[model samples]
Target: MERSQPNYRLIYHDIISIKCPGKKEECSPILNKKEISILDVIKLNMIIFGINDKETQIFNQKHRSYDESTILEILDYQAKNNLNNTQLANHFKLSRNTVAKWKKHFKNKHLHPVKAN
Candidate 1:
């Protein structure tokens, strides 16, 4: 029922398009799925830069949640950039405590980087 309704919100998606060798000229979506999580909805709704200070402060106050994969991706970014928890937090607008907690929780997990630009 939920999928039946139109999603008019400007939701962000990471669609992978590939043009197979000798297959076709046009690139096709390879891994686009219909289902998306609430975390995805909030996280993907990007806050644009150059906004007024008041708006920026208001946006920063909003609560955010990340799934396991996203957490792993953030950790991967931190590792790849050789950034400490505080630096990584600053980069991602996250609390250093949260980053530290994630590091401790997913220390043994495998890396699966999901690039979000």
Candidate 2:
């Protein structure tokens, strides 16, 4: 079965008609049919809903990067609980390689505190 594309004209009308809360001016300009694309509608919807992909990605990455204290906590949990790399990764929502890398770094830091460079 073929899927029907969304009605861009109706979407454009709805978007242009939306009134900004507590403001008298129109929400946005009425775009010409030739000027509006699917991407433009998607961006307009995102703006209306306050959903920003770029900001979401930055927030996600910031939380994903483990801090020194978090790394130590992971190491301590692994050692005390006898969890394997895969288990630790699953429990913490991290990749197996990340878990292994943290374990290696923890060991290296304790064994060799001073680095040449």
Candidate 3:
């Protein structure tokens, strides 16, 4: 015997109900589950929550961008603690690529100053 996949349509409706509460008009009806992918559900949730790519980018810029000193501190911590890029990323709330970039910049002595937005 094998377990069956959960019905995504029901899950979508449940998410919509949770997001909209008692507002039936605000919730969009799912006409065809076959037409909906995980990405579609994600987009729907983003719309319901008033989140867009621009807003996400702005949020990331505000939170994720680090100053030169902070970047150096991250590199120092990584070296002293013998941590990997993933660990540094998790500790600093940054991506692995960011940690790798900082390491590369530190080595190359080309660490760019974080621009004020």
Pick the lDDT winner: 3
Worst 10 residues of 2 by lDDT: 108-117
List the candidate 2 regions with Cα displacement exceeding 4 Å. Answer: 1-63, 108-117
Model 3, span 1-117: residue lDDT tens: 976545766776776677665533444554254555433444455556765587785675455335565567567667677777888777655787877777767864533333211
Question: Considering every candidate listed, which one attains the maximal TM-score?
Answer: 1
TM-score of each: 0.52, 0.40, 0.39
Give candidate 1 regions above 4 Å deviation. Answer: 1-61, 112-117
- Residue lDDT tens for model 1, 7-46: 4132222221122232212211211335454433433333
Clashing pairs in 2: none
lDDT, candidate 3, residue 10?
77
lDDT of all predictions: 0.54, 0.56, 0.59
Distance from true position, residue 72, model 1, in Å? 0.3
Q: Tens-digit lDDT track for model 2 on 1-117?
A: 976556766665565457433221232442444554443454454455555587774575456545565576666666666677887776755778877777667775433232111
* Candidate 2 CA-lDDT value: 0.56
Clash list (residue pairs), candidate 1: none
- TM-score: which is higher, 1 or 2? 1
lDDT of 3 at 69: 56
